[model samples]
Target chain A: MEEKCTNVCQNHLTAVGDALYVIGGKWKLRIIIALKDGHNRFNDLQRTITGISAKVLSTELKDLEMNGFVKRTVHTGTPVIVEYELTGYSDTLHEVLSALGNWGTMHREKIRAER
Target chain B: MEEKCTNVCQNHLTAVGDALYVIGGKWKLRIIIALKDGHNRFNDLQRTITGISAKVLSTELKDLEMNGFVKRTVHTGTPVIVEYELTGYSDTLHEVLSALGNWGTMHREKIRAER
Candidate 1:
């Protein structure tokens, strides 16, 4: 029981860390930004966010779902389709990304001047 | 001359990418947050941000200076003193950090409940 308790505590810490790691992964932020235009099919996201490979998109989509940042819905039909949407948990990241983008635009001139 | 221009353009792109990489290093965000309290000496930064190694701090400080996020002033005296402060370019990141912090606190309870 003591060992079990210690394992549980350590697992919780690792889980939180892993959650951050998943969110912080390369392409994940871009993916979220891509999906912000409402529900998107897999191909839509892949096309919108330049420079992301297909394999990376698939992997990051699965990780985002696992971490509850996105919801994956499958439409059962002849071809079968999957769509992704921002979960409520992901709304805050929009503000974060907006700030990043704003900073990038505002600083580009000064940054170039510095160089 | 054409090759020189290509070299210049590609070098510029690579330089921008590398600057982002440096600012996004693991300890850099935490160090920036720590220094928000006011100007601080090297030891102050090292002490305030947990889990950062001395080597990592030194490396990050130098990177911050190179990227212009921080200004380093050296006070030459009996023992040379170094101080790090946020540059004007870095002021915008304070808004970014504040948003991140606010989101973290607001979501901590819900994130815990989700697990």
Candidate 2:
């Protein structure tokens, strides 16, 4: 019989690869998190998520939009406004965020203890 | 009272940033997974992880080694062989891997369904 671990390992690699393909790089996750945290408009997002340039944020947002993680909406009022919103990613993003946070906490503790 | 969501959101951004800091970028996670998947030797790793050049792999391995994720062991025998082994990161990595894998699986399905 084929070992169960081989299957699990392959799954892990494939999943990680897919996750990385969509959400890797510096700004993508930050942009998602910032938008989730209520900073929606371009200027607000630019201000809240520090150190990101307008050009890079624009590029990353377009990429995320293409990947179905984000959708940009425009409002016509006295002044036209554009806001970035999340696609229905709660089921996927919530767990991934929590687990990643836990991993980060443990990693910091481990490194601190080692040092 | 201060908003609960603000704290949670901050935690998420911090956690994701930290985790990404430790395990982000293209090659680091791939290298770690390959090593864990039983490809231990230098040549084996180079071959198992396709499309990675010897120089880039060497650089990534050394980076991993410095970050306390990988340890290189030298066996002195007829032929001196070196193998890479993991550091004690099971508590952190196991959950992260599983979560990332699940996210990947869902993400693929979602994108496919959307199309």
Name the top TM-score candidate: 2
lDDT of 2 by residue, B2-82 (tens): 123367676777777888887888777877877788778888777766578999999988888887889999999978988
Q: For residues A1-115, could you state the per-residue lDDT of candidate 1 as single tens digits?
A: 0112234333333333333344554567667766665427876677665567899999999988987889998899979978789898888676556555555545665667778
Clashing pairs in 1: none
Name model 2 segments beyond 4 Å from true.
A1-7, A113-115, B1-5, B112-115
DockQ numbers for every candidate? 0.10, 0.49
- Could you tell me which 10 consecutive residues in candidate 1 chain A have the lowest summed lDDT? A1-10
Q: Against the unseen true structure, what C-alpha lDDT does each candidate score? A: 0.63, 0.78
Taking all chains together, each candidate's TM-score versus the true structure is 0.72, 0.86
Encode model 2's per-residue lDDT on A52-93: one tens digit a residue.
Answer: 899999999999898777989999996998989998854367
**lDDT tens digits, residue span B1-115, model 1:** 0112234333333333333344554566666656655526877676665567889899998888887788998999968988889887677676555554555555665667778
The TM-score obtained by model 2 is 0.86
Candidate 2 chain B, run of 10 with poorest lDDT: B1-10
